[model samples]
Target: RKARALLVASLLLHDFHLRFEQVRRAEVLALLRALGVPRVHEDFIFIIINFSCFEISFHPQSWVVTSLVIVI
Candidate 1:
């Protein structure tokens, strides 16, 4: 449960270092590796990082994903 949340947070976050972390997400990453689910997670992590570096979603050249934590 917490692992999944960490995975979600990883994609939603920009910097790799987190502000409030009580649980190490590495455990979840290990589980994913053991369960063969790391591919999807790694891919998304790469996408998030790529977007963060480029500040744009240019792969498909269609969608422009915004920040997950948006101000209303």
Candidate 2:
């Protein structure tokens, strides 16, 4: 059980990092949209949302800090 838990935690952290990257990219596109830039690809938006949820589920606190730092 302990080993399983550790494995799960590691997977979660890996997923969180991937999602964090996606969200960061999406936010940048969003900023561009706000600035009258052409919209980004739909696939990009979909990937961002999907990865972001994975990150949120895996590590909410880390996601918050990481996302904020990336955004800024």
Candidate 3:
């Protein structure tokens, strides 16, 4: 069915988006590890990852985003 095909495509797109985010988070944290930063808690890492994903959409270059990232 056409509807089913659309649903499958939507799901695949969502999965690809999640994978892209995971890649970005992995690269960011890997670079940090390479620079000798201490390992972060899983929850903290999640916050950073989520923030990184949204900051571009919402705040772009806002100081609020920068301050919150620093504070977290």
lDDT of 1 at 50: 39
Worst ten-residue run, lDDT, model 3? 3-12
User: Which candidate tops TM-score?
Assistant: 3
| Candidate 2 Cα outliers beyond 4 Å, as residue runs | 1-32, 36-38, 53-72
Comparison by lDDT, 2 against 3, better one: 2
Per-residue lDDT tens digits for candidate 2, residues 1-72, read: 231111112222232344444455556456546645455565655554554522343465334322211111
List, in order, the clash count of every candidate structure: 0, 0, 0
Please give the ranking of all candidate structures by lDDT, highest first, separated by commas.
2, 3, 1
Question: Residue 34 error for model 2, in Å?
Answer: 1.3
lDDT by residue (1-72, candidate 3, tens digit) is: 231111111112121233323345565456446645566455655666665523322333322222113223
Model 1 lDDT at residue 65 = 30
Angstrom error at residue 17, model 3: 15
| Cand. 1 Cα-lDDT | 0.35
Q: Give the C-alpha miss distance for residue 35 in model 3, angstroms.
A: 0.9
- Candidate 1 lDDT tens digits, 1-72: 233322222343233233222213454255345644434445544444434522233334243332231111
